[model samples]
Target: MKMAPKGNDVIVSDRKLEMILSMKGGNGEASYANNSQAQAIHAQSMLHLLRETLDNIQLMEPPSETIPFALADLGCSCGNNTLYIVDVIIKHISKRYEASGYEPPEFSAFFSDLPSNDFNTLFQLLPPIGSSMEECLASDTHRSYFAAGVPGSFYRRLFPTRSIDFFHSAFSLHWLSQVPESALDKRSMAYNKGKVYIHGANEHTANAYKKQFQTDLAAFLGARSKEMKRCGSMFLVCLGRTSADPTDQGGPGILFGTHFQDAWNDLVQEGLITGEKRDSFNIPVYASSLQEFKEVVEANGSFVINKLEVFKGGSPLVVKQPDDAAEVGQALANSCRSVAGVLVDAHIGDQLSEELFKRVERRGSCYAKELIEQLQFFHIVASLSFA
Candidate 1:
């Protein structure tokens, strides 16, 4: 079994820290605890890029220094995402090793997230598979260490300089807990209700977002530059917008951008929350126009773009309710369980959450049926490597 680092009060790994922090304040909206269909698809794309990149790399000749082959999943929150990404890397590497008639490099996998994530939830799910990280401690396949709960904001200093071989970040970086509140100020035209474009109004807001992105991008690359071996590869898949228009939307067809706004409105109309509370909460996600994302990567000196692809990241979850109120109520209860904390914090309260369900039940299945049809999301994936 992989052991925790000595002297650390929190036993979580670095990657797990990234995941947890990404999940903090999610309460119900973006909890990693709830499985999304996009997880597997994102994993597949990451694995594909990793395999291709690894195949093209030229291993050093004998008498050379030892090159530690490592893979890290940044913002790999708790639940299936962390494990799924890890499995993809392992499977891809194994396939290439067998085909080339060469021994596989030693593998060290890192799972990073924020300090607030559930490390135990992730640790408990580590696969006890053959020649896995645990088994590699004694065998030759590779030594895989499952470290948990390492903070992701420390991306610049994430790993030992030049120590990583392969890296991946999925569905995590889009969230910047520190995004300025002004970015969401509706009066500024920077954001319209349900609109997600960054044009017009305050140049300062845009610049602030830009500055953070630039700093984070630089830190991310710089940190990886130190930790990655020469010619190492990295893949980053994040939630992004294909359009520059705030109204343009994509992603899982069910949870469209409108649904988010609608849900917020629901809470507001019920007198369970206030505008001040809404203003305080900012989902620090910027759906980068392809141009915006490229500019950020180009500004960072250490890495070069290999393949940049924008693809679908989520599917609509069809919510079907029975004509009867009782069964329909149960379904709504289960759906909101992950988001209950946020709802209560918004002043809906625990008792209110239940009452809200009852309200949905009273509206009958028609309103619930209409809700599932309207929500959707969008995303993008970019693959890069050390220059």
Candidate 2:
């Protein structure tokens, strides 16, 4: 039972400062696009849950004239995944219109992410206006499709009041707006020493993470509340823990953190990075339990959960037939590096990330075979309607 942080000595920021928490952009070797197969799988799973909610929107009485339907994908990184999601949504909506004998409303899609995200790459990958529609909707319906990038943190309001009709986000909300202040404050009991995240950390460290998540999640819901129209629905999919216990270490959180720790430890041993640097660093990610997610949504009193589920995620690192440890290890390392390289580089210097991940690949090779066996990775999908 670790003691909680004393008083309010932790320096909490009033303003939600924009920081560089996005994945490596573009289609480069280390880019998120190349390493986001697992995320793409999660997105595909979420589409099944979104069909009903989207049908509900079409069920609403047809408005006078073709009112432009607005859809926003929050935390849309630079990749074809977001475009693929957008296409799916548009295709489903078109099908609903066709069934009801109603003309499909023109689409006004917004792809949003932190300012640092590669909008250039995203736009480049976006199918030409008529191309995507031709493949799904009938060519006769001259339903114009428009897309634009919204750059900023989703923890704050990004769209106008009551503008969004549908909102979707995948594999993003698990990230907190910022690292917990207590984890960085040396005087705080919640200081997370010698860990990049709250893996095997103390109870206080976990509490610190939980508190930050609650705040950020509230802010997220509040912002969306203002932007979403009445009866509008949001689909969110992200990593989550099954158990309420934060110290269980039975999930992806611990597995990934342990891999990073092992890599960092090797660096320390090699005199590449100092032990003190490793002690002070903590990744700004928290995987919440289903109960906690419900609590936050209910506490917000704005959105009602239409659907909530937890499902195991298939590991992208596994290979069929003869499994080569080296190949498997490198695949796992690349996946982790693509998403976390930015944060790791910021703290430990960009010069060492390549070498550090190489060590991680080598160290993680032995356990690569067991990656797919663990039932730790969970995909939490929730469909929420504005109440």
Which segments of candidate 1 are over 4 A away from where they belong?
Answer: 1-31, 45-47, 60-68, 129-149, 184-215, 246-249, 252-257, 316-376
Worst 10 residues of 2 by lDDT: 3-12
Q: Write the per-residue lDDT of candidate 1 for residues 1-387, one digit (tens) a residue.
A: 233432211122323222333342332433546534445655564565656666655554433324445677777666766776676675566556546665555556777776665666776767553554336435434325435456546455777777767777877655553455456566653443332223332455556565665566666666777877776787777666666643333442123233343455565576665545444343444555566678777877677787776766543232344344444433433333332333222333345444544444444344554444443345567777777
* TM-score, predicted candidate 1 vs. hidden true structure: 0.71
Model 2, span 114-225: residue lDDT tens = 9878789888876556755554465523334699999999999999998898999988888888889899788999988777778788999999888898898899999999
- The segments of candidate 2 whose C-alpha lies over 4 angstroms from its true place after superposition are 1-17, 58-66, 131-144, 316-322
lDDT of each: 0.53, 0.76
The TM-score values for the models, in the order shown, are 0.71, 0.90
lDDT of candidate 2 at residue 305, scale 0 to 100: 86
Estimate the Cα RMSD of every predicted model relative to the unseen true structure. 8.4, 6.0
Among all windows of 10 consecutive residues in model 1, the one with the lowest summed lDDT is 5-14
